[model samples]
Target: MMLREVNTQGETKSGEMIAEMIIECIKEAGHENVVQVVTDNASNCVKACALISAKFPTILWTPCVVHTLNLALKNICAPVHNPRSNEDVYDACYWIKSISEDVTWIKNFIMNHGMRLVMFT
Candidate 1:
């Protein structure tokens, strides 16, 4: 269950804020019940998890596999040229871009629809 969704549109989500949010949730849920904390592998999230691990040495921090796979797929299907290089390294696999777009659409559909999201989770 999600504890809270902070409005981060214009706000800076620093490591301290993220760590505090997780710690707050842990406190509410009872510290002893928390064995692991999982978050997407973003730089700030990684830092936050590190801080959390330091605060609660027993609780393990894990990166979300889905996020990792999504990032991998993004790099493969939407290969951008390097700043110095003018060629697409994966131009031969451009066909995969359409499939990736469709997958993104499906994910957005499920996530946007309350009932579908509930069922998916």
Candidate 2:
């Protein structure tokens, strides 16, 4: 559950700033009530989690698995605009490209049709 949303739209999101925001949320939620903190493995987030862990020894810090896997998939499914090198990598792992295309088609098919989208929802 999200405790609160802070409007830090233009603020610099350094590790320290991120840590302070997370710490505030944790304090508001009650430190003892928070057993774990999960965040994506960005440099700032990693540093923030480290700071939070140091401050609250009892709280476990874990990298977000979904975010990690999405990072891995990004290279295969959505690489930079270098077709030759990307095609070479995709050829080596053909199934990855095929599955990604299939998934995109499936998503579009479902989303384009209101009836289909409603069924899933």
Candidate 3:
């Protein structure tokens, strides 16, 4: 189940609870049957993995390869002069999320375009 944070005057589940739910999912999925839990590189996701590691002690929480690459790219592509710029991080994260969100279609389009190029040649 997804998690939602409640405001001071509101009520909702917290990130910690979300992490616990993710661990519960791993448990419900069964220890021997599951191989990995791949997720984004958000802070909450990281915390979730930590919770899994601490509680489960068996299931592997694999950070997505694409997410790792995005992190590496973020560090490398950060503005040289503006080290503390949030805009750069936001733009990079937005594009990365977009690409991952529609990865299957993007791959298909690239393949189709590549075939068309071969036909033209």
Candidate 4:
């Protein structure tokens, strides 16, 4: 379903084609009991959702939770960072995520901060 990025071997078409493909797959399946199709909140996914809704008429198409989290993170931090600065928001997010995933580092941080850790952010 990942239709982005391709070589000159005619591997893909425009974004619209991806949308059409989703619809085609649903129709091809011939299943009348489909409930929903969950997708990321990308523009292409939006287009695909629209197409599927128009065709299915009864099925719900919604954004994935992971994509929503990424969008929320971007919206909350993108404006606070300087676009011209070398310190990118994405890098900061990755650093925070990486450190949080490390149990020892998190325990040390929590121990150093004590009760103040709750208000550290």
TM-scores, all models, native as reference: 0.75, 0.69, 0.48, 0.51
Clashes of each: 0, 0, 0, 0
The digit string of per-residue lDDT tens for model 1 on 3-109 reads 66676788788999999989999899887999999999999999999999998999999999999988867777645533343245567667777888998999899
Report the lDDT tens digits of candidate 2 across residue range 65-111.
Answer: 97887667767666564454566776677678677778779878977
- Extract clashing residue pairs from model 3: none
Clashes in model 4: which pairs? none
CA displacement after TM-score superposition, residue 97 of candidate 2 (Å): 2.7
Candidate 4 ranges beyond 4 A from true positions? 1-15, 74-121
In the order shown, what is each candidate's alpha-carbon RMSD? Answer: 3.5, 5.2, 11.4, 12.8
Models ranked on TM-score: 1, 2, 4, 3
For candidate 3, write residues 27-109 as lDDT tens digits.
67676766667778777777877877777677788878987886665554554545666775666566665455486577679
In terms of TM-score, which candidate is stronger, 2 or 3? 2
- The predicted structure with the larger TM-score, 1 or 4, is 1
